[model samples]
Structures are given as C-alpha cells and as structure tokens.
Target: MAFFKSRDEKKSEEIYKIIMDTLKNRGNQVYDLKVEFQEGVVTLSGVCDSEATRKKAILCAELAEGVKKVNSDPLLLSEAAAQEQAAAVPPAAPVSPNPPIQTAPPAAPSVQTAPAAPVSESPLETGFPSAEAEAAELKPSPEPQPSPQAPETAARSAQPSEPVQPQAEMQTYTIKSGDTLSKIAKQFYGQANKYMVIFEANRDVIKDPDRIYPGQTIRIPPLP
Candidate 1:
C-alpha cells in the first residue's frame, strides 16, 4: 500500500528527526517520545525515565531551527520514583466505630471586687520650683555655625571644568584583497583578537567579521 503525506507533514517529520538527533547526541534517552510541528509550533509528548531527560528533550526541540514555540505534556515519574512516593505517604488512620459522647458545658462563677479608697494629694514644697520653671531655667546653647570655608569650596566647584579632548578621530582603512579583520586589527591595534573593535565600529559596512571584500572602507576605532 502506498501512503501519501503533505508538504507540512514532511517538514514536521524533518524537524522531529533533527530534534531527536540533537537530543540523542546530548546522551538523553527519549523512549516512546513523539514530536509534532505545525505552523512553527513544536510539541513534545511521551514517557521518559527522569525529569532531566524530559526537560532536556523539550529544550532541544526549542533550539531547533524554525521552532517558534515549544509545548510539552506533563511528564510522569518513572516506576521507581512512583513506588518511592507511594511508600512515603502515610496510611490513613483507622476510623472509630462508636460515636464520641457529648459533654455538657460548665457554668462560669461570678467574681466580686471591693471598691477602691479615695487617694489624697500631698502639697508641693514651697522651696522647690515647678517642672515648667525648671525647664525655663535650663536653656540649650545655639549650635556652632558652618565654617566660612564652605563658600570657598563652593566657588572652586562652580568654576568651569577643563574641556575634555575628543578621542583620536576614527581612522579608516580600505579593505584590500586577501585582507582579514584579524590582519587589519594586528596592523592597527597590534592585537588580532581586537578585530571585534573594528567590526563593531563598522557594522554598517562590514556585516560579517569572517568576510570582508576589497574596496570596502571600514572604520578602525582607537585602542583602549
């Protein structure tokens, strides 16, 4: 019997193969796993042994080219973990057959308190002054004023700062045949790895660091 598949199904199969290959290469086992793709959405479902394997499978699918979104079904723990979890749960306590007897509430006793006797105030001594009079007698001295030197410091700070000199004007280099970014960087900055500086400066002109053509002028930024 001949079986026909649509273009979308073929694409989905290809994507699934790539994702499975990538996961296998990572040393993660995907048993009974199924991957499906539709309109850039990728879904992964099936049984796996460990949570790590399940998550790694999903991540691998997500990283696959053209994968817009990744959806995964809830992963079930392996049989060993399920058994361990089952063993961890305590069994329910046995229920009593006979109903508990109800008890009557106890009555609260009345409490009696004796009346308090009136208090008499003692007259203040004539020799000692009242609290207000004592507070008025003791006045705090004023705090020392800020030093006049602050004004001189302020004046110095107010003075215009020295103008900063601009970094050496950006230099340019016309790319020649057989010239690489590393070669150009070594020629200008004495460090081949510093080619990134030139690439960053001339992103508008140079799109790829590995590829530069002749007659393309690129900016060479000043060294740190």
Candidate 2:
C-alpha cells in the first residue's frame, strides 16, 4: 500500500509542476503559481490579468504529463475584456484603401456596451436611425427561431464573473513522517532547490528548516 501511495503521489507532483511551469513560460507570469495536486486531478484557483490567460492556463494543465483530468470551475476569466484588449492593440501597417472590417458577432454584447461608454464623449446619434426604427432593427426577426450560430458565439464570449478568493482561506499543510524539505519543495514547485520557497512561505512558523518535525502544521503562504 505504501509503495502504491508513493507512486500516486509522485505522479500528482509531476503533473502539477509541469502544468504550472508551462503557464509561467507562455503567460509571462513572473512567478511559478502555487498549486496543490492530489490523486490524478488538478485544481487551478488563482488570479490572472485577463480571461485569455485563464483559458490558456487551463489548456496548459490539460496538456501536462500524467494529468488524468482537470477541474476549472475555480478558474476566473474575463473573455470579453481580453478580446477587446486584443482588438485595441495597434496594427503595424498604415490604414490603406478601405478594407473589409471584421464585424463582431451579433451575440457579442460587448459591442453595444463598448459603444455606450464612448457615446458620451463622441456623438454616434447621426449614424443609426431614430428610436422606433432602431428598436425594430435591434429586435429579433419574425420566424422567432433561435439562430444556429448564437450558441457557439455565446459559448466563446463567456467569462467567469464569480468571486474566487476562498481558495486560499484557511488552507495549510503539515509535515508528515519521513518528509524532507527538498521533497516538499519538489512537490509544490518543479525544482527540489525551491525548498527555500516553502521556508519563505512559512517563515513565521518555521524558526529553522532543520527544526521541523512530524505533525507540525503551517500555513501555505501565497506565492510571491
């Protein structure tokens, strides 16, 4: 049983570290994310700049070695915002003869919301028709049927709006029998030398690395 348990634990460690490292490199996040893996499943619960990063993080985890499955309900995303940010980026070449513009999907609620904010500063009233005509145009057409493409577009534009702070609340780990600092470091991070990471995270509880013993519980500090 002990041998089986050790192998399972090692598999978890490999999966977690490989995924975190992948995200750090691709996402340009400065620090390796703090991850906790058990069994063959991985949970990602953390803050990221935008929804693109969040989705990319999950995808990276899914591709990691030995990861059986991934749970991303805890993932936080801002898809609309990320898409807008990408759109806002400047193009390298100068605007030439009027080229075809990519119209946002009708399901993109963001275009309406975006134009609303800018409308206060600049007049957009002249382009569209009067209130009654505009309302009619905005209304869903007769045939009263759902568009086949609506669901697919809406699925792509969706983002996580729920708050996700409790992932860190009251969470801590204890040193068990036969565990060493290097081993704990390797489990939490990809490298064994990152034992300093564990030490630093639990500085208040740990007077010295050498003094830690079995059953000594400590707070799992937030990654720097």
Winner by lDDT = 1
The lDDT values for all models are 0.77, 0.66
Please, what are the lDDT tens digits per residue for candidate 2 over residues 132-216? 9979889987787765767767877785554323223334778999887777666555456767767876888888986788898
Worst 10 residues of 2 by lDDT: 162-171
Model 1 residue pairs with clashes: none
The alpha-carbon RMSD values of the candidates against the true structure, listed in the order shown, are 50.0, 67.4
In angstroms, give how far residue 35 of model 1 lies from its true place: 1.2
Name the regions of candidate 1 deviating beyond 4 angstroms: 1-4, 81-224
Clashing pairs in 2: 51-78
| lDDT per residue (tens digit) for residues 3-35 in model 1 | 999766776787668757876787766667777
Where in model 2 is the C-alpha error above 4 Å?
1-9, 30-32, 78-224
Reference-based TM-score of each model: 0.33, 0.28
Pick out the ten consecutive residues of candidate 1 with the lowest summed lDDT.
Answer: 161-170
Candidate 1, after superposition: displacement of residue 42 in Å? Answer: 1.4
